[model samples]
Target: MKRSLSLPGIAYGGDYNPEQWPEEVWAEDVRLMREAGVTLVSVGIFSWALLEPSEGVYDFSRMDRILDLLHANGIAADLATPTAAPPAWFFRAHPEALPVDRDGRTLSYGSRQTFCPSSPAYREAALRIARELARRYADHPAVVMWHVHNEYGCHNAECHCDTSAEAFRAWLRDRYTTLDALNEAWGTTFWSQRYHDWDEILPPRATGAVPNPTHRLDWRRFCSDALLALYTAERDVLREAAPLTPATTNFMVMHNFDALDYWRWAPELDIVSNDHYLRSTDPESEIDLALSADLVRSLAGGPWLLMEHSTGAVNWQPVNRAKRPGELRRNALAHVARGADGIAYFQWRAARAGAEQWHSAMLPHAGTDSQIWRDVVRLGADLKALSQVRGSAGTAEVAVVWDWNARWALELPSQPSEEVRYLDTVRSWYEPLWRSGVAVDFVRPDADLSAYRLVLAPALYLVDDAGAANLTGFAERGGTLVVGFHSGMVDENCHVRLGGYPGAFRAALGVRTDELFPLLPGETLGLTGEVPAGASATLWSERLRFEGAEVIAAYADGPLTGVPAVTRHGWGAGTAWYLATQPDAVTLAALLDRIRTEAGVEPVLDGIPEGVETARRRGQDADYLFLIDHGGRGAELRVPSGATELLTGERIEDGVLTLPPGEVAVVRHPR
Candidate 1:
């Protein structure tokens, strides 16, 4: 709601590190930016070492020139604090500031994010630099937004050093307040892990065997808070200098990183931005893109920004596959369709040297002759064409419950099965909903479910008392809730529920799970009952004992053969469906189809089918329908007769628009 960047349309730009290039190329950079319609560029993100060559010695000449150049060219800036990578000189002055691995090995300062989150020396230096930057650029006309510390906790989320251990103790003391309370919450009675004094407690570092689940879970919470504390500290400094400017840090809500809980961090930010790249392993990364964008959008509760993504292959992955022709525009527009207000890539110009030289950029190393550069220029025009689409909002009828705290507990040391991943399980349900052409929004379990007709709770290993009540209450109301396997198994403290599995939902579900029946990898079992024929499941199964529930399906050959594998229970005015198995894609799609019909929750668009994604955005002038084709062939979409396709400026008098593979159509229907 509080976007500081007042642009003509959706922002189109990328991170610009002019320090990487010589001064001679600076003129051409802005010239090409103008040619490509670059509106905003993130500056000084990884320039800490160069900007502060010595301790407290400021060298603002380079950055000053960079800002001047961008301002002169009429481009806005999202100035950064450059705290992500502390200088080597600072590290040398405080070697202990370097992060320590879980095994107690001190990591060197060669890479970015090498400083420990809890180190006083690192914190002081970072804040000092931020203060200096804010004081200098507070009134700079080029500066539109303050980007606090690039992507917090990407590399060093957890630090096992002595300083971090002390900080962890302090954090725990603040949370638990008393040793007895801490002991009870942590269940320290088992394995003699109790703490009589706060000083005795330390982070869950490497041990002889599996560490305490509660200990690990709390440590994850502490690490996220520590990193967030770093962001808030810098943000306060910027706020003091530039009080009106909005501040935000880019979040990696994608699959790779899951350290910081954006649900906790979202409130602290004035704007929400996320960096996502298409994973090579996932051939259907397009659906994953929708999933990630939807989560970020819901966190923002409105439009967000795509801070960084690859124009081509990312250097970090094992096999960095390049984005096929037209894929770049497809990816960018997909984010826009999912409530992204702007689009930006990782870097403006490709790095000539360093760790991320191979990472794709707007201007590759091959210069303007490449297809990537051509596409970049075209995307800018395409964004400019849909200027009216900015500030549009997306609404969803279905919500997928996401709790980062639960994610931490689900992935802790010991569990039913390693394959029962938190994000994977959530996506198992989300993918089907996406393919079904249903628009989904992500929310915490305790968040208000009144807006949604259907809510999916998946992989919620740890649920607090409040969340448990909230889910039960939602089901008791008119909202149809789907409880997945491995959810509601434990409380917030990682303690297993006493009465039965999924203890949090037994009463509302009208059934109880006695035990878990985890299947081996590559193993699957069939189901018999109301589900589609050949409906089977993989990876997980559970023992169900019904109190008063209708069986939707029964396990045919698993450990709980002839027992109910899926159950539906009706409470007051709503319904709760419990799927005790990780159903195959076909089974989940079929099952969700039934649930959608019963709940009266349908896809966003009627004729939209699988392999093509569609989402509607409401604007003051009209309702915009985004049609993205990910299939192998062509597809046709019918819209209002008076609608106009914004991308191609084609007036749709016939109410039919043809979309080929890897293409996109944005049809604006007059209100």
Candidate 2:
């Protein structure tokens, strides 16, 4: 039952929608797919309208033919349930199926994922399609895996409709059981908002007054749960019908539009797959991409799928700038470097019409003569050549704790400052690690920390008593722990831990916060003690008192200049470090450098160039080292003397390796 990629090497094609083209075009498309070394194609996504034009009617004739053609061409199929976008007729028949936004306005049918997760009608329809697809393609030679509804809750994660309100109430009842418990947990006595009955509760809609923080927190949890329920319903049907074919729903990793707790969903899936789209705003899109891939691999506990990414410019961004000459290849290899079993795009051919017509694909609208097509073909060949990477697992000695609950709690109406964004701050802290070539795995706060040498909780603002004990246990058991500012400040209910700031972690961290002095947008305080001479603190600062911990760095020049900015405490057999303010990049990197050195955490590869990224994939007998040069310059890299470069089959006995600009190399070292 080790569920994994069914294909031999990295499954290299992408979303192939043959139904959109004429019947005559399919054969040529298949021919081109073969030429491009397409091992797998995800078919039938968003094809519900064509499959079942009316209620209880499914014509799989064309779908069957497409599968047969793919089979004939020796290409595997990742068959989708086509439930992402239900037919327009189904919406006309059951208008209640539509989702309502925060303002309580019903979203129309024309867009994808328009259905409300809590709507019984929508669930019934989605399940029917899932069951049908499972039944028909269970034993098909071409179908290797079942792709569940595309990007669950991408657009409709939260709804303010009556159905959702009722669902939220039911969820709350299940969680709290009694009105007394609910009232206590929500702190309803604060604003005379105590609930005597479940019927009084409503979804947090757009209103002049801010909703209860606990209420909003629970609502976000419920919304994620409701969507997960829909995905589970479909997944169960597919599991029952096609037990052998692994089922997966493509997750939009760290996508702002959806808030589904992937940790909860990971257990239900046989294999984890994710759709990662690079943000245009991020200058370090490569690092962000690697972070997301590592997260998906961690969720699977093994290699996962890069189910969807753009080949070039995506249509959704405000300014859709096409990727430069070698960018696509770099992006694809980056995912593979992390631990992607498959390298796929959002689409095969560019759409001719509709909302995503301009979204770049493996094959553009200009046909196979373009540079994008040439890159696609080259990537496919490269993957085929480096097939040894399949089934390899990415190894990381450091784990960063991530929690959707903390994210929701941090974004609540009342907090320290609007500048403290959760994931952004986490990535900012992670940037130094990534730059230093450290492999990272994102884990839950409650996840077992014994596997990691060091654990960093970046803005883990919300935690339960159990979570607090978990981190403390990690430190006591000889694991180095780093707690950022604002962490452990509140409980699961968004209530302050009143004895002092950073209440839950106080005993473990051996530090107490007196007061929080949040800096303005452009303000910064210079550092003096323990830290590099002239290092500055920005965004936030806390006047901290060392209960038992030794001061690491102290603020140099401000109202709290004499106080400690950073502190480290030696507990049991391990040490715990705390940052009382947001450190600048140089300081953060310097801090991590010390931590890394102390924890005995070494980079995957030594002497890696500044802009070159390195990731190691471990196999039974050897390891594959992936080096990607995003610096646009060539560099000489050191490798194991006897290792062989897989892509070029060159022996590196001298241990000196050269990487060209925008190129990639995978070196295999025998264990």
Candidate 3:
């Protein structure tokens, strides 16, 4: 069934914890929120202590009043199950719920998510609380969604206790089935670490030295599965009472919680939700956030929620930098441009005490008249005015392939170059198209590539026969293919494919690599053709030999000097480009520009300066243009001459629309 939300216009507002404040402040908060046009409020986060002050005792009186007030004030609610942290009374009664660290020390509740996921006592207690919450409030028309646990994963390298050890063994047995199979998979014969029994297998821990990388990798996979099992158990219980309500858990972008596979977790979720934070100064931050957004959209194959974002600066990082004047508004627009169905900040009210006390909030304890509060209010008004244009936005024509199994297979390799990071390579390919205002959809490896004119696969280190066939088929049918180094070397099982490098893709790419020149850090290599400045040639550079391809650029210097750095292979009516070295941003951008022209790909907007992003989504009766100003200086954007700015009701038929820093314009052209 297709899922949809009731709240209109990019569900605005954020995490609101009014329970901590006195009732006297309720009226003021409601006024401030309504003034900002804030429509949705996420309540009950981090409220386990308030909800269950004592074991076997439940209290929702405070939460009830908060929700009632929000609903009465015309605000929708996304109620969270306050199960992120258990109450101290429950922990004291059931000490077994504590998670043990890798060094075998049991953890105490100094922070949230301290409970062990595999603990039976913890699961039972958490389910009881979730069931109670759903039963009591499932019928509330104001409640739109159920937020399970807040960011469900371990924060540190822990959970190596006895319970985890037992769970690890069970997880392995289900995966490998036999001791010999496990031994072979992990290559346990090396270092005389062959396991004689399933009992011998232990979870990865700091206490013991990791002599085998394969074993450590497997343990990571096992740990992720264990947590997924816990999440699934909780979700099942919630579905029993509120079967109609969508259940979701917030995810941190590119977070590696023992390699928890989000692709595997997507189907179980009603809508993918994530927290994206990027400063305004960073050039690639917006693109990075877009990658994460595309990743979630591809995982769910639909629109997702922007669960949490810093309204300004975050207090956690070593550098606490606030968003400059118009930065917050720009970031919000960027989210909508990338297919976000809802936008919510991390916090509503600033914390008066605790670790997050210094973090920025919509309404600081200093009150709602502050500069940050006013900015949020203005942005909220813009969002409310644009709500009528909801679901009438940009659509992506190009799809970038994102495969979880391939990502896992690449990372699992025991000897792959450490410099070939997955996320970094993916970003390298994505940023060029993003800056060029290309609407990109992150598609799974199995998705149909025919819809896209260009398909890019960066550091696709693992390629099964089926995936290889898909790529080859796409190219054979006149689709342009762009691939990067270290790709097509291994299979799904992390085993090297024989015959040659890029085993299954040798014929499709029209190239074969005989040797790889592993370049050390600070190594310099020049390209024969025009190259981008500041591009690092680090990591292992492959010395290539083309079978039926022409070299576009060769290394200008080095031992493999004058060898192929980039090659183009003609396959049927289309062509494929194999990049053997990481080029600088300028060179990469130029290369992408050339490819776009050759493939007849049209940009949504042309000649936009750096920090400005543009995207277009068209429906049967309307065309929506999402213009975001990422630049620090306000600039005039040349809208398509006759479009009208939907947010401000301004006509752009004869002149350019001037957008301030971090400002967004949603222009609609009625058909």
* TM-score on alpha carbons, each prediction: 0.99, 0.98, 0.93
- On the 0 to 100 scale, the lDDT of residue 187 in model 2 is 96
**Order the candidates by lDDT, highest first — what do you get?**
1, 2, 3
- Model 2 misplacement above 4 A: none
Deviation (Å) of 493 in candidate 3: 2.4
lDDT of each: 0.90, 0.89, 0.77
What does candidate 3's lDDT look like per residue over 1-671, in tens digits? 43457776778989888877788988888888898888888889789888877876878898888888888999998888887878888788888888888767888986888887778888888888888888888888779888888887746324787787888888888888898888877777777889998887777667444446666656666766777777777777877877777878887755333256676777878878887777444655777777777777667666688889988888877787887777777777777766777888979889888888888888866676678888898888777766655665346767777776566666653454655667777777789888898888876665778778988877777777788878877888999988888787776555677877666677777888877776666666777754554443556577688899888777877888777788889888888888888876677788888887788888887778887888776656877788887666667877767778978888898758888776778887776
Q: In candidate 3, list every pair of residues with a backbone clash.
A: 393-617, 394-616, 394-617, 395-617, 532-587
Which runs of model 3 end up more than 4 angstroms from their true locations? 154-158, 207-211, 255-258, 279-284, 404-416, 530-536, 634-636, 660-662
lDDT of 1: 0.90
Candidate with the larger lDDT of 2 and 3: 2
Residue 158 in model 2: shift from native, Å?
Answer: 0.8
